[model samples]
Target: MASMELTDGYDEECFRTIVLAGSPQELRERRIACQSILLEQLNVIPIEEWMFRVNTMHDLIAETAVLICEAQMKEAGYGPPPCTYSFIVFGSSGRQEATLWSDQDNGLIVEGEPDGEKNRYFEFFGIMLSDLLEEVGYEKCAGKVMCSQGMWRKTLSEWKEQLKEWRTQLEWEPIRYLIISSDMRHVAGSTELSALWQKAFYEGFIDNEELSVAVLRNTVRHKATLNLLGQVLTERFGDYAGGFDIKYGVYIPLVNIVRRLSLLHRIRASSTLERIEELERLHKYQHLDDIQRAFLLAMRMRVNTPFSVQNGLLISSDYIAESELKNKQLLSELRESLLLVRRLHRALQRQLRSAERWRT
Candidate 1:
C-alpha cells in the first residue's frame, strides 16, 4: 500500500496530482486506493482526530474534483459559470462525522437571478460535479440530495424561498428536508452563500413554536436500540439478522438531539461534538460532558467495526457480533452507551415540553 501519511499542511498540488493523473476509467480505482490508504490509518487515530483528518481529506477530494470538472466543461465548449456558487454538504459529511464509507449528500447554492439561462448553467455544473465525485468513489445519495437534482441545485433566492416554504408548511417531508439542511456546511465555492442560507434558517426557526414541536416530534421518533431487558436490539431478519443498526439506533438519535438543541439555542456549529460543547459553554444542559464522552465512545465503536455496505452506502450495521457481546466489558460499554442515549432523549423531551408549556 502507498504511504498514507498526510502532509503537514494543505497540499492542493499533491491532491491534484493524484486525482488528475488518472483517466476517467481509472479514477474510481485511484480514489479507492486513496481511501484504502486513509482507512488503514483511521483505526489507530483518536475518533476526533480521525474525523478532522478524514473531513479534510474529503474536502481536498471535492476541491480537486470541482477543478477537474471545470476543465472538462471548458473542453466541452461551455463557458465559465455565470455567477458565484457554493457547494454545500449535509448529513455526516456536513457535520464532519463521516465514517470510512459515505455517500454524497450535497447541494448547490448559486448566486444569480432565478432565470432559465442561469439555471441551465448551474444545472450543467451540478451534473459535471456530481459525476466527477462519483468517479472519485462518492456514491450519489440515495435520497437524491446531490446537486445534480433540480430541487437541490438552486439560486440563493430559490433556496430562501424553499426555506420559507419548509418553515411555513410544516409538512413531514419539508420539515425533514429542513432538518437535514440544518447541517449544511460549505465545502467549496462561495463560502458566504451557505452562511446566508443558515442565517435565514436559524432566524426562521428561532421563535417558531409550531416548528420546534414538529422538529422535536420528528427527532424523537427513532427509538433507542436497547430493549427493556437491557440487551442490545439486533435485527430479527434480513441479511443483517442478529446485528444491531448502530447508525440509526445510537448515532442518529444523538445527532438528532444535538441538532434540535442547536436549533433551540440558535447555535451555528454543525458537528455534534461542537454543538454539545457550545451547549455546555452556555450551561444549557446537564451531564453534557458525560454525553460527549458517550458520543465519542459510540463514534469509536462505529469506526472500529467493519460495516456492511451495499452500492457504496453504509448499511447501518454497527453490528456487534454475538461473541463480542458475550464479553462482559464490551457488553457493559454498549449498554452504558445506549442507556446514555435513552437518558439524553428523555432530557430533551423534558426540555421540549417545558418550552411548549411556556409557549402555551
Candidate 2:
C-alpha cells in the first residue's frame, strides 16, 4: 500500500515536470498547453492582468496551431513531394498576432508537376487541415476563406488565374483580398510554394497600372481614431464602457494602409516592420517613418498583452480599455501609432483619388 501511494505521487510529479523542465522542447510543449488553457480561460481574467498572460498565450497557440496544421497535412498525403510548397497563413494568423479565436485566412503555393492528382491532393489536405484546426479551437471563417473552402484552395495556375480575374474586376471585395493576402507568411509545408507566389505576384501585379488604383481606393475606408481635439474616439459598446475596436479601430487600419502601399509597389515582405523598411527603401514615404515605427511598436505591445484573450471572448478587441495601458511607454507609443495610421489613411484617400483620375 505504501509503495502504491509513493508510485501515484511520482506519477503526479512527472506530470508537473514538463512545466519545470529546462529544455526548450519541454518548455515549448508546456507553453502550448498553458496557452490553450489561457485562451480557454481568458473570458474571466481581469483586464489588468492582460499584458503578460494574453500575449504569451497568443504566441504559443498560434505556433501550436500551425504545428498541428503541418502534421495534419502529412497525414493527408499533401506533404510536399521532393519539390517545395508553402503553407501560407494570411490576415491575423499570418501576422502571428492571432487571439484565442480567429477565422481561417490562408493560401497555398505549389511548384510541382502539373499532375492533376497532386493538385487535388493538396486541396484535400488543406481542407482537412482547416477542419482539424476548427475542432481544436479556431472558428471557421464565416465567408469560408479557409483552406477547407474550395475558393481558397487552389493550384499555382488556379491562384494566378484567380488573381488576374480579381484584378480585372477591381471591386471592393477583390481589393480586400489583395490587402489581406499581403499579410501571408509561410508557416510550414513547402517553402517553394510561397516563394513562387511571391515572385509571381510582385512581378506581375505591382506594376499593373490599372490594379494599383483599385487597391489604393480600398485602403482608406476609415478615419483616425482621435478627432481634431486629440481625444480618443468611443464606440457604442465594449471596454471603457464605450470605446473603439482596437483591432479594427487602430491596428487593421495601419496594417491595411501599409499593405496597400507595399502591394502597390510590390515590396514582397509580409511582416509590417519588414514592409516599413521596404517602403523606406523604395523612398515612397520618408516622413512617415516615425509613425510606422510607432505603429509597429504598438502592434507588438498589443500582441504582447493579454487583452487579446479577453477580446477573443467578446469577439472584439474594442473592449480593451485605455485604462489597461498601465505601461506609459506602450500607451504613448500606441496612441502615436494610431495617429500615424490616421495620417496614412488620409494620404491613401488622396492617392486613390489621383489613381482614379489617372485610370480614367
Candidate 3:
C-alpha cells in the first residue's frame, strides 16, 4: 500500500504477485496461497499488522480485478469505462478491518449523468466484477450491498440524492444505511470522486443537528454482551450455544458506541480505531487505552473464531467456540473489554437521553 516494504511474514512478493495476477482465476489462486501463508502466521503476527496485511491484500486483489474486468469489458465490445468510476467498500472492508474470511461489501460510483447507455454498460460491468470477485473467493454480500445491484451502483449525482433520502428519513432502516455510509472507502478508480462522495456525506452531517441523535437512536440497537452483574453473555441456544457471539456481543457494541461518539465529536474516520484516537484527542472519549486494548482483543478474537476452509475459501463464523471460552487469559481480556463496552453503552444512552430532552 503506502510502500511494498513489508516485513516479518507479510510476503511483499506474494502481494506483488497478486497485483500482477493475469486472470480472475490467477487472482483466486494467489489469494488462496496468501491465505495459507497468513493463517500459518496468524498468531505470530500482531492483529494490527495482520489486519493491515489482509485488508491490503484485499485492496490489491480488488484493484487488479478491476483492471482485468475493464480489459474484458473492452474485449467484449463495451469499450472503456465511458466515465470515471470508484469501486468502494462498506463495513469491515471499508474500515480496513477485514479478517481473513470477510465477504464482499462494495459498490461502484460512476462519474456522469444517470443515462441509459452508461447505466447499461456499468450494469454489465458491475455484474462481471461481482462475479469475478466471487470467483476470487469473496462471497457476495447477502444484503446485496455489492455493485451488481443498481441501488449500490449509481452515478455520483445519484449517490448524493440517495444519501439525502437516507438522511431525511431518519428511520431505522435509513439510519442503518447512514451508518454504513460512514464506512465507505474508495478502493479503486477516481479517488477524487470517492473523496467528494464522502465529503458530501459528512458536510451534510455538519448541518443536521438531529441526524446524530437519529444515528444514536440507531446505534444503541446493539445486542448486549454484558449483563447488569458485569457477566459475559454467551449464546443461550443455537448451533453456537454456550459460545460467545464475539461479533455482535463484543465487537459491534464497542464499534457502535465509538461510532456514535465519533459522529457527535465530528471525528471523520472510517476506522473504529482511528475514530477512538480522534475522540481521545478531542477528550470526547476518556477511556482511550481501555478502548484500544479491548478493541484489539475483540478483533483478535473475531479473527480467531472458528472458521472452515470450504471450496478454497475461509468460511468464518462470528462466534468463539465454547471450548475456547475456557481459556483463562481470553476470558479475563474479554470480561474487561465487555465492561468497557458496557460503560460506553451507558455513556451513549446518556447522550441520547440528553438529545431527546433537547428536542423536548
Candidate 4:
C-alpha cells in the first residue's frame, strides 16, 4: 500500500501541497498536472510501471479529496465525524487496477448502528467526496454505486445484514451485488471496520455452492471478441465504429475468469494479477501463465485505447481505434490475446455447465 503513495515527483510533500491548495480550481489543476506527467511516461515505461504510476496519482488525488472533505465539513459546523466510519472504494479503485479515467466506485462504512445523525453526516460527506473527486476528474459511476447512494452508505452492522440477505437470495441481482462487493477494499478510515466488513463477505462463500455457481454463470457470460474465422470483432457502427472494445472484449472478460476461479477455490484476493499469483501458488490452474500474459496485454492495450483531452482531463471511449488496429503487428498481438480469452471463456462455460449437471 505504501507503494500506492509516492511515485518519483509525487511524494508525500507533493500530496501535502495538493491538500493545502488554495481552492478547488487549484486542486484540480494540480491533479491534472500530475496526470499529464503520467501521460508523458505512458508508452515510454514498462506497462506494469505505467499502471502503477497511474494508480499512484489516483490514490494521491483521492486521499487529498478525503482530507479536504473533512476540513470542509468542519468549517461548515459538522465538527469531526460523529462516529468512527470508513471511506471504502469499490470496483477498479478497490482492486488497485484503476486507469487514469476511472469513475467513482466508492462507499461509506460507518461504525455502530444506523441512525439519523450519522446517516446525515455521511450523506453530506459522501456528496462532498464525490464532488471533490469529480472536480479533480473521476466521473461518477453511471450505475450509481458510489458512496452518495443510500444503498452503499451504511453502518458496518447494516452492511453485514445486507450481505447476509444478498447471500441468501441466490438470484441474479443479489448475486451481482455480492460479486461487486467481492472487490471491496478499504481506501480510508478505520481499517478494523473494513476488516470486519470483509470477514462478513468472504465467509459467505463457505458451504455456498449454489451461490458460487450463480456467480460463475455471470462470470462466463462475456462479449465475443473474435469471430469463428479468428478475425477480430470491431464495433460495427456508432461513434466507436470499427474500434475494438479492449475493456469488455478482453480485459473484463479475463478479469471475470480469474475472479471466478479464485472465488471457487475460496481465494479472496481482489486484483486480477494477485488472484492469478495466488492461484498459481496453490497450483489451481494450468493455463495461468498464459492468462497472466494475455491479461497484462489487455491492461496495456486498454490504457492504450483512444482518449480525448477535454479540460485537461482524459475522456475515453475505452475502445482501441480502428486506425490503430490496422497495424499488422498490433492486430496480431490483439488476436493472440482475444484467442486466449475466447478459449478460456468457452472452457469456463463448459465448467459451469458441468457443475450444474452434477448438481442435478
Candidate lDDT (C-alpha), each: 0.77, 0.60, 0.87, 0.83
In angstroms, the error of model 4 at 80 is 1.6
lDDT (10s digit) by residue, model 4, range 144-241 = 98888888989989999999999889888888888888888787788899999998888888988888889988888889788879999999989889
Worst 10 residues of 4 by lDDT: 1-10
Which ranges in model 4 have alpha carbons more than 4 Å from their true place? Answer: 1-16
Count of clashing residue pairs in every prediction: 0, 7, 0, 0
Q: Which parts of model 3 have CA positions greater than 4 angstroms off?
A: 1-5, 8-10
Model 2 vs. true fold: TM:
0.71
Clashes of 3: 0
TM-scores, all candidates, are 0.89, 0.71, 0.96, 0.95
What's the residue-level lDDT of 346 in candidate 3? 77
Candidate 1's error at 96, in angstroms?
0.8
Q: Per-residue lDDT of 135-205 in model 1, one digit per residue for the tens? A: 76677899999999988988889899999999888778889999999998888888888888888888897
Error of 2 at 44 (Å): 23
- Candidates 3 and 4 compared: the better one by TM-score is 3
Top TM-score prediction, candidate number: 3
- lDDT by residue (13-91, candidate 2, tens digit) is 4335433543334444554455555545443443223323443343344445555555556766666443455567787
